[model samples]
Target chain A: MAPTLGKRKRITRDELEQPSRPPSPSSASSESESDSEDVQDIFRRAFEAKFKPLEVDSKKPRVEEVNLELEDQEEEDSDWSGITSDEEEQVQVVEYSHLRHTGDRASKAEQRAFMSSKPPTLSGSTLFKTRPSTKAPADENDLTEASHLKNDVALQRLLRDSHLLSSTSTSGTSTPTLSAVGSQRHKSTDLHLLSLGAKSSIHAQKNMPMSHRIGISAKAKEREERRRAEAKENGVILEKERRAKKFTKERERGVGGPGVGKFRGGTLSLSKKDVRDITSSGGGRGGKGKGKRGRR
Target chain B: MTDETTQTLLKFTGHRHLPSRLLLSTLTGRPIRISQIRPNNVSRQGLQPHEVSFIRLLDSITNGSKIEFGMSGSTLVYRPGLITGSAEGLGASGGVLRHELGRGCEGRGVSWWIIPLCILSSFSKGHMNVIFHGEGCVTGAHPVSGDLSVDSVRTAILPLYKQFGIERDIELRVLKRSCAPSGGKSAGGEVQIVFNHQVRLPKTLHLLNPGRVKRIRGVAYAIGVGGSNNARSIESARGVLNKFVPDTYIFSDVSGAPFIQTPNDKNNPSGKKKGAVGFGLSLVAESSTGCLYSADVASPPEGGTTPEDVGRQCAYQLLEVIQQGGCVSRSAAETVFCLMAMGSEDVGRIAMGRDVIASENTIQLGRDLREFGGAGWGFRDKGEGSEEVVVSVVGRGVGNVGRKAV
Candidate 1:
């Protein structure tokens, strides 16, 4: 599908005002000269179909784009129901022309059916009543992406809270705080907060491509920083730790100042002269030469 | 967790080898009852501090476990529970949320504790990242707390695990090394481990011949002592092992000791802070056919087991392990034997040379494996003397269903 920036279907003022008017399957299939105004009507309807979702809502300020998109679709389907045969063909031709660029028209239909069949609720519902194919995280990620579009104020606050919580947990033990959050999350059935290992099916994410649905590697850029930060965590078993900033420092910290043990185990007090004696005389660590083979 | 009513209790006489019994019981999901736990002795009848510590450790990683005592701490009852996946699942949401191992304080007998735990890892669902806190980890061979260190586990038992099919992403890392008898100094030398688990059973450990020893590597550790002490021990060990293996190198490490304040200087036993100092050494021998045999020796509490003696003893112990003619070492033989017999239904073999018979502990372990099902299995000495004896078995294919599908 073309990106949202390219190829928008413009709406005439008529469809914008009368979006609820239903289309007929049996529109007048008569001679064209008498019904010239109908050609203009078709363009108005086509324009409304193309760009109505992108229009700003002057009405209720808080309705989510997802719902607006769903509401727009419901209106279009209702309009199509009343259109006559030849007019229906014209209206559908326009719909198909616009939809072919935006992939998966069937998903749009499915979503319309979903929104209509089940009433959207303000509060989260259990998994049993959720749309047959859409798993919970998909909905969450969709909301997250929508908010991500332009400095999602809500998402930023949530991210800040999550960031603080993660930093505190990593710095030390914050079991009580985590338990409290867990309790709060339990009270509200936020799917991400719950440790439910439900196997995700495809329908819930049909709107998203496989890449966006997985949300794994595409997030690698953000994940790289996390990996670096986490490399400081307990420890990773590596054959050779690259001299990255993470591995340069010591892991097992020392006792407080002048406390008990030395900084790292202990050190040999070898005078400069004694050091020369060991190294210059060909003795010390990582010995290179062959051992003096005693005549057996 | 399992139902108590479904259990047919396996009974034992005393507290001897209780860890093995408890591990086997946990693995098999069987309830156990031991009536005469030193019932004859009466005074020292109840479980020791370490044994009780082991039980607490087991409880930490499991769900719905129950334990009861009867007959004045002599008779005991324990019902097995499910192996809860990870104590801290994913640690947090995203930073490093691969899998959870678990967190527990392995008080004593950790050497024995790790064997059963690693065996469990083989049958678990995902990767496990376990962290152990508290003391008694870095010490030498103690009767209560077993000696095997993280270093020993990495060099010795891990190879055997590889032979058994868990070949990737296995680690035994010592984040902090501590000696035994840490008297409230700090978190007694922390260690973290990451173990990978798969669905399939472990493959056979068919190390038929170890060939001849080619090279030797060792570590000489001196806590709160000068590096000279470590160097002294390394030089001494070389004197003995050099005759057989020319490529012998012992790296010397000198770590500062934890300070212990006593009523007077005389009462201080370890001499770590009060000046006597601590020293120990471990050696590993590599043969031509890529088999490893290892041994370790440590200083005693009385400031005995001098550096020279430590190096010499460690080297000699390695010699003993190599002379046994099998690919496995004496210290690790018991662990290797148990994994082979307990793994899925497949024939596993280990070459045992007459230079050393299986230790009494290994023999007891063989008997214990039999009790937990693994039928038609025993220690078979195939050779009288010269060639290595091969002990083979077909396991019961006992896979742990405790780990759920993640």
Candidate 2:
């Protein structure tokens, strides 16, 4: 197949070289005698039927002229025959059986692994040295691992916020899947924060007027009382209500104030509790046993 | 505690395998009395300077160790002490122990002390960080005494400790490189070893299979010599090793000669003189199973060989070590066996070449362990017509006494 391809390429090259040959005398001779040319064309057609077709101006006349010129040259050139046969020389095939490195060249990571102060491990210099291999299989593995992590995070988020989805659906939101919209998104975030041990809701107001706070508490208490009374009348069991603990506020004292009472404008004032404590014989805790102290 | 004072000291004669004997005594907390140390040598009898230096090093690391030497220095008694390592106020400053080897210790390489010290460091109570420096520290392989180069110890021996669960923070840093001194010259090499991993008991090792060698890595170091020596050695070594293992790479390290103070010299009392200078090659062949085989060669002290010869000799030596067919090389066998014996009370097995097992040092070590009250080794031929032998050693269960309660 290769030999035939080479021969066809040579024929094409000959066609290209034809115009550069100064319109050789062979073409002129063929035009002068139409009878002989017709005979030659008929023979060529028969030969083309049996085998490969021949060129119109074959290289025989040019080669004869070149041979005559070579024969007239010096005798020293007689021993040398130019243009040997076109058969390709037998390729001197040299096969090496020794193991050869066919992969990428040694990288910097491998150099570091081997040249570091630490002893080079078996897999360090050879197999897994290249930390950023980025090959097909390794890249595929990394992609799958990353996707798995992403999916895991998504699953955890879904489970944690499933109740929010149900509550939003009952409220008649249009897009009621795992995704929350607008206010529902804020509610979802609040719930997530609360689950993560937030002390108070983000929506809780930090400061308000005293009357407004009192009115709000009173209204909430009245609503609870009404619900409980209605539940009792209807003979329906209801969960126990939780009461918020109340904190007592003590009076603030300055750093240099009297121990028992406040000092107001260069005057020291004491309360009845402070006087009873001062009259007692023992210290603060011992003052509880006032009768024993009096007997003593 | 009272009975420890009344315990009889194990008695032995001659100075053969003195380092191993001392190491075992320290590990097992047994006192030993060795007599007749080169008693017949009229010129230089008794313990050599290096031996005395080793004893001094031991004394500095340990506390309350009682040592007694006879008038002639031929008879000696060493009562073992707790392995304290480089504790504060015990010949250590700032957590590092500095030991200076004098000029008399130039006959033996520094590895002669380091290898044994490493074995003891594993069982020490605290971290062992030691810097060995001075005129006698030869970091290269000893051409006459056959001690391994510091590179081989760091690359080959230290890696084996990982199998025993003692791999953390372990490093051997060669601060200055110097070859063995020729004639009366001195070597001013500096080396530091940081072994911060101390274990109550080294994990039992059961290594049997020595897999095929897959790659060869090496370091060709030239000190106070032309850099072309490194290239020449790497070329010749590769010429030999590339035929078998095509994955071979050798790194070249070039450094200038070290300078040390010549204090006692009358001509230049305050001046500094250059130390030994030469080139060397250390080759390590790692097997598929993480086993390592190493070979070391350096320029001889008399200095008549070419770098090519040194490289070719080292490559062939590495091939011979690989052909020995074991999970550990002969140079590291002592450390492996000692750690095995000092492990937990369980049987640990290792496959070694027959020649390695039959070596005199191995036989002497077996004897020394028995004398130190450790269990004897059990040996059997590795099956399937292999020349390797499987050796089984049982631990004494008496690991680091300082860490026993912990």
Give the candidate number with the greatest DockQ: 2
Two-chain complex of model 1, DockQ on C-alpha atoms against the true structure:
0.00
Per residue, candidate 2 scores C-alpha lDDT tens digits across A162-189 of 8878887787846578776677678778
- The RMSD (Cα, Å) of candidate 2 is 11.7
- Model 1 agreement with the true structure over B1-406: per-residue lDDT tens digits: 2346567788887887787788777766777887777776755667755566667656655566678888577777888776653445323132122221112232352455566666666665455556654433443333224466455565566666666666676666555444444333321444556675544556666777777787666566676767887877877788788767666766655667644334345756654442224677767677766677878776664564567887788788888777777767767776677667666677877677654444776667768777777665545666655566677777667665654343
**Highest-TM-score candidate:** 2
Identify the CAPRI category of the predicted complex in candidate 2.
Answer: acceptable
Model 1 TM-score on a 0 to 1 scale: 0.51
What's every prediction's RMSD, in angstroms? 38.5, 11.7
Expressed as tens digits, the lDDT of each residue in A192-252 for candidate 1 is 4332554543224447577775685448655765676677684754344344375654345
Residue B27 in candidate 2, Cα distance off native in Å: 1.5
Interface RMSD of each: 29.6, 3.1
lDDT of each: 0.57, 0.82
Residue range B1-406, candidate 2, lDDT tens digits = 4566577999989988998998888888888999999999998899988898899889878877778998888988998788899999999999999999888888888999999999999999898999999899999998888999888998889889999988888888889998899977899999998888999999999999998999888888998999899889988998899889888888788999999888778987768898888999999999988899999999998888999999999999999999988888899999999999999999999999987888899989999999989889999988988899999999988888888878
